[model samples]
Target: MEPKPATPLLNKETPIIQSKPNKKDFLNHLEAYLAKRDGVDKLLKISRYAAKIVLTSSALPETLTLTHRLMSFESSVGVSRKAFRLGKFVQDVNALRSSHFDSTEDVFLSIVAYGGEGVYFFVEQFVWLVKSGLIDKKHARRLGLMSAWAEFVGYLGSVSLKMRDLNRIKEEEKRVKMSIEVAITRGIKCEEEKERLGKLIEKKLMKRFSVVQDLADALMAVADIRDGKGHFLGPLSVSIAGLLSALISTHKNWVSC
Candidate 1:
């Protein structure tokens, strides 16, 4: 018999969602992931059989403030696994816990819908609505936007970043710029789509003498702002938003493919 062909199981498409060795110590982190999706019971069932993981206990405190935060982050839907990995949602509870609350969620949502995304950031604006001196810590959870939308947006953000990164290292010439533009304009869903976008952009912008990586960077920031909102416990409005201000002119330096 011919030797069996090697498996492609190690391919990058398959990301290993590892369970922390001490999950109990990181229940907050697990909760952040779980609260972002719909159907907890099903996810629980899935986790049970995925490489020696333990089911989470439901005995967490139910403060109304945090409850509201979780509700805000969660949607009535979930993202499909079939969707591409946007950015890797590293469940870094430590980052969240330790990162001083210097910024608001506005920094994440201004590019998409400004009002709701912005309002979520500034707690000072809501001081009158609360009793007194009660800071809400429930802002860490998030739910998807209408089934798989969260994952899709995340994938888009990550891909956009990759394209911007690729664009910075090329020269301004017909063919050279063409190739770089081609590689940078690819879609966010998968490798095939990214490659396809790259080719199309190259064909269109081959003669482009000027390119603005800053504008491209700003455009990428748009996705981060929009999708970052979904990472919150619920959909929110932001305050004090920043401009996606990138001034790209015809005279700027562009790359050649």
Candidate 2:
């Protein structure tokens, strides 16, 4: 029989004594902690409130002729005007909230769900009206060609869908960063277009507006512990309390206003 080599002490296979916690379990625990502090509820409330405000402000911009016409019809309907408007607003809000919360990136959903979807809905109506000859060719041209409206809606839909998954959001951020880098190196040929894209990237692509800043702060503490830094529960508690304080202050300010 061939002689078997003895295993070196240093190189011997030692089973892992402990494995990392499941990610979903980790998230559930975090969510429970946050829920105790009312963090998750506040995120949902703020998202809906913010969406209502944005939807009203953007749904009837000067460029949307079709939406204006619809509003005119609603007004002419007399007794049903207020009810019609309220019903529509509620419907939009429900749809927006469903889509928004389904996404991992709540911040992006906060803005885009209300603002982007409002615009997209009008664009769809406008294109339909134009194609059906209900809108004059000259008026349609003034508002914007159907092709342009369709393209804009498509862009908004694509972005909204992409926000649903965290991996997709991160991938999109990488792609946007690369495009901007290429633009800088190659030099944008159209100054106007470059400025427009820059603003879109700044305002829509890069911005994250949400009430979860404290949760993120708590996460930093978790990261520090994972990195072998001494654990400090005080920081995490303070972060959670700070968000609650902020919410109270905001409510007071709004009431005063």
Alpha-carbon TM-score of each model against the true structure: 0.17, 0.24
In angstroms, the error of model 2 at 254 is: 46
Give candidate 2 regions above 4 Å deviation: 1-92, 99-105, 145-164, 168-257
lDDT of 2: 0.42
Per-residue lDDT for 45-160 in model 1, tens only?
Answer: 23322211111122334554654444333321112221112221222223233434223542232222222222222221232122122434342222222212332333343344
Model 2: which ten-residue window has the lowest total lDDT? 78-87
**Please, what are the lDDT tens digits per residue for candidate 2 over residues 46-162?**
443333333344655657775566545433332221122222334445666676354455655455445444554455455445545677766655344433343333335434444
Best by TM-score: 2
RMSD for all candidates, in order, please. Answer: 19.8, 24.0
lDDT of 2 at 216: 37
Give me the overall lDDT of model 1. Answer: 0.31
Checking candidate 2 for backbone clashes, the offending pairs are none
